[model samples]
Target: MQEIVSLNNRISQVIDNIKKVMIGKENVIVLSLTALLAEGHVLIEDVPGVGKTMLVRSLAKSLDCDFTRIQFTPDLLPSDVTGVSIYNPKEMAFEFRQGPIFGNVVLADEINRTSPKTQSALLEGMEEKSITTDGKTTALKRPFFVMATQNPIEYEGTYPLPEAQLDRFLLKINMGYPTMEEELEMLARTSQNHPIDTLDSVMTIDELLRTQEEVKAVYIDETVQQYIVNLIRESRKHPSIYLGVSPRGSIALMKAAKAYAYIKGRDFVLPDDVKYLAPFVMAHRIILHSEATYEGLTQLQVIEALIEDTYIPIRKEL
Candidate 1:
């Protein structure tokens, strides 16, 4: 749609501005923005001090959305995340106190540090865009997205996210250490204040919602769709993987591939889009067998092999 085109231009401009603060990782920034436009949550799994929170904060600042950061810890309670229902003695009725989950952009810093029960509180919000409390439901703001961060599994004090929770995220990305030049520039900039403070909003909330619609409408040939499905099927069959991508993962890859195509300024998706996104869209959702890990095979590496092992169909350009 023409409306989508306008929103696409706006998104491009916004990411460009965020780049000034983020300084490198253009691909990661675009993917984050893509997940936002798709109205999906993004789980950023990387170690601390690599600008994970900063990336989310900068995007929040750029969107002018209500930003809330929940520092997940071992002691965090479920009600602490989904909000609690309280009785007001004066009103003689139970009323709900909204929690940080109400915001448009939620920075779930160290999400894995929280207990499994606490992490489960986000499921309803992430999937249904609403939260239920005391037999009543409250709708989350439009364009709601959770940008969750977690350290690598090897890190201490981290718990693995439940399979149910992991499937809800549209994509998982890592913001690895910046290049040497970018790091030097970061040091020079941080001498004053955080670079994110200098960022500005790129588009309005309505514009963001419109962009999500656009990604849904991005053209994908039937053959390409089948290609995506085949890849998911192979993941299930692969010897290395104990658990493959679910039906949800199949759809996530399709949407992410469409978003990736649009970022390259294409209205229609190509095979490369599927290949580039296969790892990020499918990797985190998979479970590698203990034997595979013992043999030093990673889930992502297995996914890469699956993509290679599967038969890919070629599509004619629209």
Candidate 2:
């Protein structure tokens, strides 16, 4: 229990630093870092000017982790993302040249702008946390995370991510438009200087590893586990849904909820924690029916319907 509290404090310190640059949207910041500690990737889908790229940079800065940005575009190639093996004529040997993916925090800015092939290059890295080049495989550093961003408003030239690739991400989040007061404060603060430039590292790699270990130790009630499974099963049963949450989605929700509990400074899980994270964890994994699509309904709204329909487990005294 003491260990859990210590990790909670460590996570809080790191998040407080990131919020300095991100301004409002504390929930978004919490979800991003939770995914990180859960040892999973994140997909940020929002409109432009919402600070998607800035969020990635700020996270890397606050953790003192290695940061690399890959501006994916139509012209981007697979080798450009995963690097290539070059035969050095001077040494008469093939030397492995690494790519931007060799970092603790990789910012795949405008990921959907690239062709499918280029976008798929991230698949191996995100899933395996490693890359293969010329039949050679290399391991990425610990705490490796891919914080990818996409512009939801514009899809004219973008290649949509396939379900298989989408399933790899633990959670899908968005930095919604800030309130007027928050925006005004942002303008006042950044009038002469960007807040991120002055940000400092709040945690080390070892500290993060420790916190991740602590998250696994969080207690999940048996009823809560049943709630998670039934909620996922319900996604498949929804009348507007053609497809449902896969087994991978179920596991993602479980892991994310545990991390969410830790962030709330609790050693035991809660139904509310699982409920709060359900949409983001299952939204991208769900497939709606043609009729539902024609109605212009969103996956988020559908998940909300499921949440309302599902029975919330009553909390029992431990």
Candidate 3:
């Protein structure tokens, strides 16, 4: 019990620290941290100036981790992202130079603007946590997280992320426009200096890594596990979906649920956790049929329908 309380307090501290820079996006903040604890990547789709970069920067700062920002463009090369081997005349050897991808928190800004080939460079790093170049692989740093952002309003010259790339992201979220009051508060706060510049590290990278391991220990009931599987199975059978979520979706949800439970200071997961996270975790992974798209149906609507119709297991006592 004491350990749970301690964990909750530490998580709360990081959340609060991020909230200082991000005015009123606690839910987005929580979801991003959930991905971090789950050891999964995030895909943030939103309009410009919605604090996407700020959120990633604040997260890296709050955890005291190495932060790297890669402004992906059409000219971006695979070697530019994963690094390349350069010949060293003195040693008569080819030396591998690490790219911006080798950081604790890497923000792939405008990720969709790059070519598909350049975008795929992240596949190996996100999946294997290592970069293989010239038949040699280099392990990435611990707590390695990729928070990628794409502009949804503008689609010209942007390459849509392939399904393989989308599946690697555990959660797809957006930072919507803030309320008037929140915007006013933000204006007042930034009148003199930006809040992020003054932001302090509230959690260490070592502590974050330890918390991630602890999150995996959070117990999940067999009934809840079945519920997760059912949701994934239903997506495959849904008439609107062209390509349903893969098994990876189920695993991602279960892992996310455990991390969510841990963040809430609970040792066991509840059905409510799955219910709240379904859309964010599964929606982006599905592909709507051409007919369904023509009918004006959306992914979130389909996911919500599944949740509404799917049976919810009775809450099991911890």
Candidate 4:
């Protein structure tokens, strides 16, 4: 019980640190932190200039982790993202130069603007946590998290992310335009100087790694586990859907729920946790049929329908 309280306080400190720079996006911040604690990547789709890059920077600062930003473009190559080997005249041997991908928190800005080939370069590292080049595999640092952003309003030259790549992201979120009051606060805060310039690290990398271990230890009941599986299975059977979520999606949802439960100061997961996280975790993984698209159906609507139709498991006493 005391450990849970301590964990909550530590998480709160990091959250508050990020809030210094980011205004009126508490849910987005918590969801991003949930993905990090789950050891999963995030896909943020929204209009430009909504603090997508700032959020990543603030997170890296708050966690005291190495930060790298990759401004993805049409001409970006595989070698550019995962690094390349070069011949060293002094050593007379090929040496590998680490790319921006080799960081604790990597911001893949405008990811959809890049070519598909270059985009695929992230797959190996995102899934395996290591990049292989010239028959050599180098491990990435611990707590490696990728926060990728894409502009949804522009489609002129952007390449749509493949379903496989989308599935790799544990959550798909949008940082919508802020309220008038929030924007006013933002203007006042940035009038003097950017708050991010003075933002300090509230937590250490080692402490974050330890917290992740604790998240993994959060208890989940058998009934709740079955409920998660049932939800995934239902997505496959839904008539409005084309390609349903894969087993990997189920695992991602379960892991995300555990992390979210841990963040809420609970040692055990409840059905409500799964219910709240379903759309963000499962919606992107499924593909609606062409007919369904023509009928004006959206992914969120389909996910919500699934949630409404699915039975919520009764909470069991721990």
Angstrom error at residue 312, model 3: 1.2
Misplaced by over 4 Å in model 4 are 315-318
Q: C-alpha displacement of 181 in model 2, angstroms? A: 0.9
Model 3 spans > 4 angstroms off: 315-318
The TM-scores, one per candidate, come to: 0.96, 0.96, 0.98, 0.98
- Between candidates 2 and 3, which one is better according to TM-score? 3
Per-residue alpha-carbon lDDT of candidate 1 for residues 29-50, written as tens digits (9 for 90 to 100): 9889778766778999887788
What are the lDDT scores of the predictions, listed in order?
0.86, 0.89, 0.93, 0.94
RMSD of 4: 1.4
In the predicted model 4, the residue pairs found to clash are none
Per-residue C-alpha lDDT of model 3 across residues 186-305, encoded as one tens digit per residue: 999999999999899988888888899888889998899989998999999998999999999999999999889888889899999999999999999999999998999989999999
Q: Model 2: per-residue lDDT, tens digit, 75-185?
A: 999998888889999999998888898989999988888887888898998888888888888998888999999887456778888888889999999888999999998
- Counting clashing residue pairs in each candidate, in order, gives 1, 0, 0, 0
TM-score of 4: 0.98
| Higher-lDDT candidate of 2 and 3 | 3
Q: What residue pairs clash in candidate 1, if any at all?
A: 62-201
